[model samples]
Every structure is written in structure tokens, then in C-alpha cells.
Target chain A: METKKKKPRYDFILILILAVAGLGILAFAFLTGGGGASVEVSVDGRIIAVYPLSDNREEVINTPEGKNRLEIKDGRVRVTDADCPDKLCVNQGWISMKGQSVICLPHKLTVKITGEEAPESKGADIVVK
Target chain B: MKDNKGKNNIRQKQYIRSVTSHGMLVAMAIVLSWLEAQIPAFFAVPGMKLGITNIVVVTALYKMSSPSAMGINILRIILVSFMFGGPSAMIYSLSGGMLSTLIMILLKKIRHFSITAVSIAGGVFHNIGQVAAAAVILNTDGIFWYLSVLWFTGMVTGTLIGILSSQLVKRLPDSLFSLRSGGTK
Candidate 1:
């Protein structure tokens, strides 16, 4: 006896639901990019420092994995340089908008822009690190 | 004595066939994973993957027993991580792989959803596991904020994988799968 193959059926409703949900989240991520006044830097998930966007300075972040140079100027922040192999963070460019972040996965470091009024909680408004 | 010998011979042949089939699936999964790693992330968000490897996992789940599918999935993660990634990568992949596999298995057992739904759930759970691992390693709750975006990516990728796997399974020859035992439905 031949074992008949079953034809695969797709649930269009499930796909539609997922598509709507996905688009909603993507929209939220983009729409929330308001101007931010401060940038918070974290290494190994701990907040190392918070620099005001009003200040123009370069700070070198050193962690056990590697080192990264963060440059803050003109209300924008970016990783100017890093020793990590990919250097993805350096290429991510500057972010001065709320909910924007620059992350170095190799070094497990993250820099995020925050509003002038720091939230009492240390958690990020949007986790992109 | 003759009957026992014949049965033993058939069992040995089945075992060899099963191992070979599982090995082929693992190799396919590894190649897909490697291919995915070569493509630059489309989104700026970290840890985003196309999840093409999931096609093999989903196919395995439907075509073989839960244990066989799971064994193949775990083996693929370990081998791929060791070959292409660092210790941290291994941890993240392991966490994600295990969680996704568990969710898929549960969903499969329920039989209420289509393969696409199961794959989507697997994708979402995989991201959650990775985020949880990152949060623990980094010691920050900040990573949780990334979950929303990850979930969005997961659903999109998962749906694609689900469609691909369902088609692949339909095309596969029944003889390639062990018919003697260790298959559900």
C-alpha cells in the first residue's frame, strides 16, 4: 500500500494576525524617536554613566570583552571606535532621538538616548542592545 | 534462532537508515545557519536572524518523533555554535534553541494550529530566550525593551520558515523517513 502524502494547508488568519502585530511594533519603534537630552551608557547590562547631550565629549568605555570610544556631541551620541571584530557599533552612526540605541554585541555594551528627566528605573525605554 | 537473526538484521538496517537521515537533516540545518550568518542584519536591532534554519527543525518535528527532532535540533545548535561562534554565542543559541523547541513541541501536540502558527510561536519564544540570556549576562533589565521588536521580527521570519517547511515535508519521500518506529502521525 502506498502511503499518501498530505497536502499542507496554511492558516491565512494566523498569518494576518501576525503581520498586523509585527507592523504595529515596527511602527511604534519608529514613531517614538523623539529628541532626547541625555545619553546613558551601559556595559555588561549595568549603567556605567549618563552623559548629558548638552556636553560635547568623548569617553572610552572599557569592559572585560573589549573597549569602545563613545563620542557625544551636538545632542547626538555614537560609538566612534571600538576594538571588536565586527565594529557594528561604530557603523551604527549617531543617535539623538528617544528610543534609539547603539549596541556593540561583541563587547556587550550599549548606549541609549534618554529624555532630560531620567526615569527612576534603570531599565531602557526600548531594549535594542 | 533464524527468526531472531532476521529480526536483528532488520533492526540494524533501520538504525543505520535513521542515523543517516538525521545526519543529513543536521547538515542541512548547519548549512542554512551558516548562510544566514553571512547576510548582514537588515535591521539595526541586535540578534536579529532570518531564522532559515528553523525550516529543518519544523520539518523534522512533523516527519519524525519528538525525541528525534529534538536531538537533531540540539546537535545542530552545538555544532554550529562551536564552528562559527564564540562561547557567548553558544549560550545565546542554546537558550533560544531549547526554548523554541519546547514551544514548538507543545504546540504540535495541541494540533489546533497549523504548522505556520507553531513556527511563529517557536520564533517568538526563541527571541525571548535569547533576550533573557542577554539580560542575565549583562545584568540589566534594559534588554527587555528589545523584546517587542524581536517579537515582530520573529513572527515574520517564523511564518516564512513555516511555509517553507510545510512544502518541504510534503515533497519528501516516505522511504527517506524510518517507517518502522519513532514517528508520530
Candidate 2:
């Protein structure tokens, strides 16, 4: 039979690419810890506020955006309500671990996990740069 | 004219298949959506909840078409909202779901990409989509700030869903169509 040169089908390409993307995502997740370090957001090393995942329940964290309610109901910390526009920080569910942070750009307040320390920064100072 | 007519017939047949398949997808999306809601948010941020919805959305995107996934997601949202959650969850789900669907679909088509990349892309897009949705729904641009937070979470969660989906696809081949085939896209 005279054969026609078949065109390349992209269905498999989509699956392979999705699989790779999944791998990349897996790498990032495994590398980063979901169990974030407990951090106190502050200005100039002086922790103006603190959010401990173990705190159990919503606590008012004083940020640049006035008094916003932050909670640790499940296994992470999240801003329940913020005066800041967009309320994005409030929408972000939970944060627990390295490289994870909750930011309120409009309010200039950032709650982030710097690292796992010996609780020095806990009682010391946390300055926002 | 004869050749053109033949091509038209083929195109029509393909369209019919797509439409019917999409309907089935919507039904499956509904089931998945319900299942998604039942998954207790592993971590609860008051006014927010988390689950494996992203994985299903990403998996569907990988296995099916973009519009098909989108349709399923939309149906899932409506059904789940009706079955559980209030109008609030629906708002966030719509924004995040649509974004995840669009981004994953694009990344899946990217050259030399992997499911890992698609998963991460899904994570990032899910955040962007939700933040955008928040800004629109809340009518405030400040929502973008939460993007950083969501980004990290997305990376973490999306990867998990991706891995799970990958494993699932391996165990369940395409033709088996009878196994829990409540697929949306």
C-alpha cells in the first residue's frame, strides 16, 4: 500500500509535558517544607507581631495594615481578615515552613519564614527589609 | 467541492464526539468536585480551605481538552457549592480553578516540558487566578500581595496533586474507561 507520511499527533506531547511539569512541582514541594517556621512579622528586627501555628485559633497580628486577625486552625497560619485592599493575604490559606510567607504589599507588612533557628529571632528582633 | 464536502463531514463527526465527551466530562467533574469538597482542608486558614481539587483539574487537563476541563471545573464548582460550601467558596474556586485550568493547559503544550512543570505551573496559576479573582471580587488590587504566599502553597500542593495524578494514570490505562471514570476534561 502506498503510504502517506503521517502528521505528528500532539496528544502524547501534552501528557509528557504535563508529567514533566508535575515532576518540577514535585521537586519544589519536596525541597520546601510545608511545616513553616513560626515567625513574627516586625519592622527593624523588633517583632511587632507573631503568628505561631501552634497558637490554635485566630490571633490579632499587628501589621502595617492595622489589626488583622490571623489564625492557625488547621496546620498553618493565615490572615482571616485584613484591612488591606485585595485581602489577598487573608485569602492565602495556611503557611508553615521555609520560603513561605504571607504578604500584604499594600500594607507593607510581610509575614515570612526566614529559617529554622534556635528561637533567637523569636524573642530578639524581626526587621522588615 | 467533493473533497471539501468530505472534510466537512470529518469535522462534523469530530465536533459531535467533542460535544458528547464534554457532557460526560461535566458529569465526572461533578463527582470529582463533590469528592474534592469532602477532602477536609489539610490545613485550614480561617475563611479558607484546601483540598486536592488542583490535582484533579491538572490531571483532567493532561488527559483531556482545555475547554473540557474548564466545563467540568465549572460544573464541579456549581455542584459542590450547591452540595456543600456557601457562595464564598464558589467565588474563590471559580477564580483559582479557571486560572489553574488555563495555565496548566498552556504549560502542557510547552516544548520539552514534564508533568512536574505542568503541576508547578498549575500551582502558580492557581494562585494568580485566585488573587486576580479576589481583586476583582473584592475590588482591590492589594490581593496581588497574597500571591507570594499562595505561590509557595501552590508549588507545594500542585506538586502533590501532580504526583498523585501521575501515579493514578499509570495504574489506570485509558481504555479501562469504566474505572471511576468521573473525569471532567
Candidate 3:
């Protein structure tokens, strides 16, 4: 009877390398800023967006113009009736999560929800666990 | 005729043909990912669409070794992004493919489970990976709602691809390929 060698041993070594590499990357993610709590953005019953809670955000009112009239009333977002067409800001429901964004293209106004900025200065959407 | 089975020394080269080798597998995977770009996977329910490329990922996982599958996956995501999937596909493809491969390979180690089972496991893991990425990107747990939908899709697609791969692998000649005489050692 003829004999045949088993499949090449290359696969075992290659798998080891890949596994180690994958684990290394995961570990790096944990060690880096990824381990930090994430950010979420919501608008009333409908969630428009979500993003990291990093400080890399700016409030429309915080700008030099310093005129931000958008606010949350009775758990609903109100645009204070800006000059935006379709009154989209009025359509935007609420901002109770991270990364939530409501744009009023015509009025040149927007409502953004982020982790660092919420009802209170301290982050409330996320409980670090 | 039976004598040909053991005597045809030159016929033992199909198992690892260069065109079907790991590199080719990687290239085809990339091409599959790129080609899938034209397809409209989104049902318009939300920002996310149903990812169909997991079919190819599951198939590749079964036909090739774990590392080879990983190789194919990484290349597919990179090449697909350069071609059509844009940043969104890049993120989901890489995460889904990587984690799926991990689950498929680990399941392959089980003695009794078949490739179909491996594919199911891969699909589940792929969803897990996608959801994880979604969580990271959205930075919120609200995106978890998408998992149930993905799981249903995964089960069906995974089974189909797994069956196809198993049949294909079965038909392949179980032997090591030899380099062509004109080819170098």
C-alpha cells in the first residue's frame, strides 16, 4: 500500500500567530481609550444617533454667536420655533442619549447630544461598570 | 481502472492547486467583498443594513484553514473599502470577519460537530462582532436591538453556505499538491 504524509504543518503555526495577534489587538483596545465608557444620543422616543462621549463636541450656543434657544421641555425637544424650513427642529423629539443630533438646516441651528454635555455637567447617560 | 487510483502519481496535485491555494482564496474573498458592494443590503429600517457578505465569510471559513480564512477576510475588507464599501463596510467587515473566523475555527476543533454547525457558530459570532462594533461606534447599548434580526439571517445563510462548502470540500481530492516540474521547490 502507498503511504501519504499528513497535511502540511503550516496551518498550526499560522493559527497560533493569528490567535496571538488577535488577542493582542483586543488587549490593546481595552488598554487604550476604548475601555472608557461610550457615548449615546437620543431624541425623544426615536434615537437619531450615537457616538463616543469624548470632549470633541461644541454646543451651538457655546459658539461665539452665543444664541442657543433649543431646550428639553417635558422630555421633549423644542426648537423655540427657529426660522428653519419644515421646522425640522420642532420635529426633533428629544435629546437624552449620546451622539443624538437634530439639524435645522434652514435656521443654521442644530441640537447635538453627547456624553460630556447633558441635563447636568456630569455625564448621566452612562454608568461606568 | 482501479490501478489508476494508486498509480497516477501526477494526479495527486489537486488538493493545493495554486489557483485554489491560500493566496487565491484571499484574492477571491476580496473580490467577493468588492462585488457585494453593488448589492443593496439595506432595507431602509434604520441606518444599518443587513450584511450579506457573511455568506462568503462563512464559506471561506469552512473550505480553508483558520489562518487562511483570516488572511482572506483581512484582504477582503481592505480591498473592498478601497473599491466600494466605504468606511462603514470597512468597519463592519473587518470586525465581523475576524470574530466569525475565530468562532468557526474554535468550533472546528470539536469532534462531532459538522461544518454546518461551524458555520452557525461563525454567523452568531459575526453578529456579536458587528453588534460590538455598533456599540463602540454609537457608544450606546441601544443598537443591540439589531442582533435578533442578524441572528435569524445568520442561521439561514450560515447553513446554506456551510452545506455548499462541505459538499465542495468533499469533492476535493484529499491529497497534497505537488509543485509543477517547471515550478521551483
Q: Cα deviation of A121 in candidate 3 (Å)?
A: 12
Q: lDDT by residue for model 2 over B27-98, one digit each (tens)?
A: 666766677555554443312324366555655665565666677787878778777765756787788877
Interface RMSD of 3: 12.4
Ranking by lDDT: 1, 2, 3
- Give residue A15's error in model 3 in angstroms: 25
lDDT of 2 by residue, A5-60 (tens): 46343545544554565456545644654455465564323456544544466566
lDDT of 2 at A19: 52
Report residue A50 deviation for candidate 3 (angstroms).
Answer: 12
Tell me the tens digit of each residue's lDDT in model 3 across A43-116.
22233332344434322232222243454443334345444324445555444443344444333334444434
* lDDT minimum window of 10 residues, candidate 2 chain A: A120-129
1 versus 3: better DockQ goes to? 1
lDDT winner between candidates 1 and 3: 1
Candidate 2: residue B138 Cα off by (Å): 3.6
For all candidates in order, the CA lDDT equals: 0.79, 0.58, 0.50
Candidate 1: give the clashing pairs. Answer: A127-B145, A127-B146
Model 3 chain A: ten consecutive residues of lowest lDDT: A32-41
Per-residue lDDT value at B58 in model 3: 52
Candidate 1 clashes: the total is: 2
Scored against the true structure, residue B63 in model 2 reaches a CA lDDT of: 58
**How does residue B161 of candidate 2 score in lDDT?**
71
